[model samples]
Target chain A: MHDEAVAHEFQYASASHQADTAVAGMWLFLATEVVFFGALFLSWIFARHFNQAGFDAGAERSELEIGTINTVILITGSLVYSLGVVLIEKGKTRAFIMCAAAAWLLGLAFMILKFAIEWRHDLDRHMFPGADFGITGDLAGGAKLFWSFYFFGTFVHGVHLAVGLGLVAWVILRVWQGAFSAAYLAPVLVVGLYWTFVDIVWLILYPLIYLIGRAT
Target chain B: MMRLLRGAFSGSLGTLAALFARLSPGKKEGIGWRVSGLLLTWAVMLILVGIQYGVSRLHFAPGLRPVLLVLSVIMAALAAIVFMEIGKGPGINRLFAVASLLWLLILLGLGSMDPFTRVMYYVHPS
Candidate 1:
């Protein structure tokens, strides 16, 4: 590795200082994320409450196996991310890039699974949340509460997943461009933190969405 | 397998603690311990609360919500302790702490509103 002059101009006191700054920045960003996820969760709760039986109807159709698998995948992605930072510090560039790519691919697979398969099931079941949504329970009128929440909550969460993939792509791009090194592994750690936060949100969502049975 | 995971999380957090511990002791005499304490407590509390709802027949939903929210605030405080550069920086610490507390207020206040207590109220309507 060549000793780059311009890069050494603004000298950091130590690697720890740089790491600390990045970590602090990550936490601050996560604070905003907390607000974001918090609002979505609140909305889900309100809608679910408003349409208990309808939600239960939808829940019956949820594929627990898919939910369980996705949960495991995201958790595994988190491990890859945390471990990747350490590998980068060791200067294992190949492994580091592989980990980032794996995380990205896993994330993409999750989205596809949700959109292509899980979402299809909901659509076929007429759980579209808008006009076609219905009340299968004894109570009259479409179980509007359930369908509305299911649609809105998943859509909002889908947006978060999209944002997460965007961040992962940005990180992977830097890896491909050979920007990370022992002294500058901040990007991996920060993005990894963001990834884990996304996983945590799903951790809460999975049980809430799939576990609650119908009230009828 | 689960043991390894437990080890991984604990080990990393401990390593971070050890690193901070080694740094020259500053105004926050025991910030490392405090942060670790807060994190551990918050984690355990969250799990227990989750168990209460998921498995237990308690059905203690409303009363439990506020307590869990308070614990999450504490969790955020612990996170601030670490992120604020506890052993070295204070500016970021105060900022995060204040922000977390503000969040606690807004979420709990609006969240606890009787009319808005949709989740629990619907579960066991009054």
Candidate 2:
């Protein structure tokens, strides 16, 4: 009975130990995510290397300005989320909640910009891979391959961001309910790690999808 | 040139030492400092994106493309280490953190070899 009372399933020897285990778990998950996205990157590299001209053509058609804006927003959102983590660790519950809410808003803004505005523009321009794909000539096939990777990568990334945002909302709700304190902030820290990982993924994606082929 | 390099190296070392001192135990950063750091990261990201766009406009060498990508990755890594505090936990946690990144490098490095080297054959009938 004493052992059962003392050994709660969620209990650790110390708060620090719990935090460490959570961080390790999060990193291991992120590692898998890296390999998951790495496959798409490998496909992109080979496709671009073999068909530089076609890849360049497709890259030129991307919405560079909007993509850049979204990248900036995502990184800034991560920063805000990190700030919330810091505030929570410092025992500033109200401030942490506010910062978390701001971060969530920024994430929502990014999604709206990416899907509603930029993707709609892409569809209008026939950038989507289909019978009506917008490119032509000898480079058409290669360009289609580029668009395929582009849409696939960005769609996967968007889904991840949506999941991160949901997690952020969860953290914010918990903060409002006084579920976190200086002694126990592992949840906030782990969510921040996930948010920053998403941002890192976007950092890689930006140059590949938007910056390439702009020299033309 | 030797003297210049020495001076630059010492300068960087001094800056790093100062940063460590500021972040030493029992001297946690305040909210203001955290806010400033956040803004600084945002500004750095914006500037890097601008530079990338500008470089693309110029007829720069193709090799510069990979270099710019590396630069952005480094920037992102800095944000991860500093802001996300990936290195703040116990020693084993740090090992796990580093291992994850190493595994990613291995995955990408080994995974690309097949696609990069495979030969495709095309047949034409007369």
Candidate 3:
């Protein structure tokens, strides 16, 4: 276990106090992110409300199978990450590293499935929100807007996941160097929170993007 | 043929039962339990996806869409609270977590009111 010494420059009286403050800070940052993503969701809701048929058409054209698979992959990655945290908390470093590696691989798999497979498929279908967009007819404009939102939402989400994967890799390196211990797993826990937050965003996005308009 | 089918079904059930037993909370907390938990989470997510697909196929009343969306939010909240341990921390930490959620709700609620209520300004054919 690492020594219980608090890092210099922290105003907290104890290491645990410092950890608590750090987590609180992370939560505050996440709160801001919630509102950030919330604005996009609100816009989507309005767009769908006004352009129901168009949105439905756009959604029906989406690659539902891939989106569903990616959802499962991301959620499983989050679970693996939480398990890694559990192992770390138990002072089982080797098991923690294994779980972390598994989580990272899952994260990578999600990115590949989304960007390499799904986005390419979308591009082939001309789902991009521009002059080259493929949809035609009376609802073309509205469907174009819907596709715009879809591309923006998923692209931003992918970026966040990429950042999270980087964080996971950094944590793995730290674990390899024996920097983390049962007493100081704050970085791991905080990064896991971010990863899970990304998962939560996808959970919300899954239905909106893939499920809502399928039947029609 | 009937016996073979039944045997296969029972065999799958037995395997599932054994997996659940290994994941039981009272079982020794180790890699097995953790892996089981991960699988259980995956299963729940898959079930939710099934529900989403099934509901979409049902083509329920448009008003029901919000209800279905709420269900997904609840599932995500469960993962957040349980897997992320949002509430399993110091009181202040829990306060921050709860506050973040509360603020998000406020943002969504207030931000949505305008779009929900305001009339669209369509240009007349002048």
Best by TM-score: 3
Output the worst ten-in-a-row residue range by lDDT, candidate 3 chain A.
Answer: A1-10
Candidate 1's residue-wise lDDT over A118-158, tens digit each?
A: 88987887766566564444532325555565567667777
Interface RMSD of each: 7.0, 7.3, 4.8
For candidate 1, write residues B1-126 as lDDT tens digits.
Answer: 446435644664565455445532464544334434434543453453344234422334432332333433343333333322234443673475358547945874687464354344336556
In the order shown, the candidates' DockQ scores are: 0.09, 0.29, 0.38
Comparing to the true complex, what docking class would candidate 1 get? incorrect
Off by over 4 Å in 1: A1-19, A137-142, A214-216, B1-98, B101-105, B116-126
- TM-score for candidate 1, residues paired by index: 0.65
Q: After superposition, how far is residue B55 of candidate 3 from its true place, in Å?
A: 1.9
Ranked candidates, highest TM-score first: 3, 2, 1
Q: Any residue pairs clashing in model 2, and if so which? A: none
Instruction: Considering only chain B, report the TM-score of each candidate against the true chain B.
Output: 0.37, 0.59, 0.62
How would you class the docking of model 3?
acceptable
Could you estimate the TM-score for every candidate? 0.65, 0.84, 0.86
Docking tier of model 2: it is: acceptable
